[model samples]
Target: MYQLLKQIVTTGIVTEPAPHADSALRQLEQRLSETILKHLGRALAIRHVDAGSCNGCELEIHATNSPYYNLEALGIKFVASPRHADLLLVTGPVSRNMEQALRRTYDATPEPKLVVAIGDCGCTGGVFGESYASCGRVANVIPVDVAVPGCPPPPTAIMQGILTAISARRS
Candidate 1:
């Protein structure tokens, strides 16, 4: 045990330096925080709805909340109830089963709400447009203020869409 401790003490601290922050990303986050406070007068609360996804977009969405992105630091958070949300982030195509639920959620949201359609499935229904089980795009079901199109958009894209929606609200 003494020899092991001696060996450990002999090895100096060896670790990589912390990664540099992206200036563009920091600017975006700062702008979003300022905009939300200016236009909405409070922190932005979002409700994420998965109509019928293969969980791809959800993964990207989750990444936005990680420490590196720190979405909460910019006064943005996800809520469980639509009633408490200022923005609705919807992903995936509107499936038959989730149509009514999505409508109800939209209806429950307060006035002057922002809705962002995430991913190709949520934007244009991807390859599952207007089918028996899928209802095409999110706009076909509920009005979308911003649409981020990708099979599973990156966290930055999702953040941009949210910012766009907030900007639209300002307008």
Candidate 2:
């Protein structure tokens, strides 16, 4: 135990440096903050729907909520109900079983809502493409304002997609 303490003392504080203020994430957060204020005039509530994902995209989305990303600080947050959401983040390719549900979710969201298709499966249907059970891209069933393409897009890219959807609402 004494040796461990000595080693700890020698090592000192070993922690990752704090992210730079001008980093891409910080920049995106700043833009989101401004857009939320100017466009929505309040916090942006996001509702994430998984049509038929393998959970890869969900994992990446989860990363955005970490301290490094600080999604809540940008006034953008995930919600459980579509009724309370200002934006919808849909993941994975649309499946036959989930197609109706996804449509209902879209319909439930109030007018002036924005939709962002996340991941390659959501954007282009990926390897699944259109099949007997798969409905292809998100736009195939409902309107999509922005599409973030990646098998499981990085959190930063996902953040950018959210920003892009918000910016589109402004124009």
Return the top candidate by TM-score.
Answer: 2
TM-score of 1: 0.76
Runs in model 1 lying further than 4 Å from the true structure: 1-42, 168-171
Residue-level lDDT of model 1, residues 5-82, one tens digit each, is 998788654332222322322112233454554655347899999998889999999988875566666677999899
- Taken over the whole model, the C-alpha lDDT of each candidate is 0.77, 0.79
Which candidate has the top score in lDDT?
Answer: 2
Per-residue lDDT of 106 in model 2: 98
Query: Model 2 clash pairs?
Result: none
1-171: candidate 2 lDDT, tens digit per residue? 999999879976533322222122221222344444466634789999999988999999998887667777777899999999988899999999999999999999997677888999998899899999999998899988778888899887888877666652232
TM-score (C-alpha, index-matched) for candidate 2 = 0.77
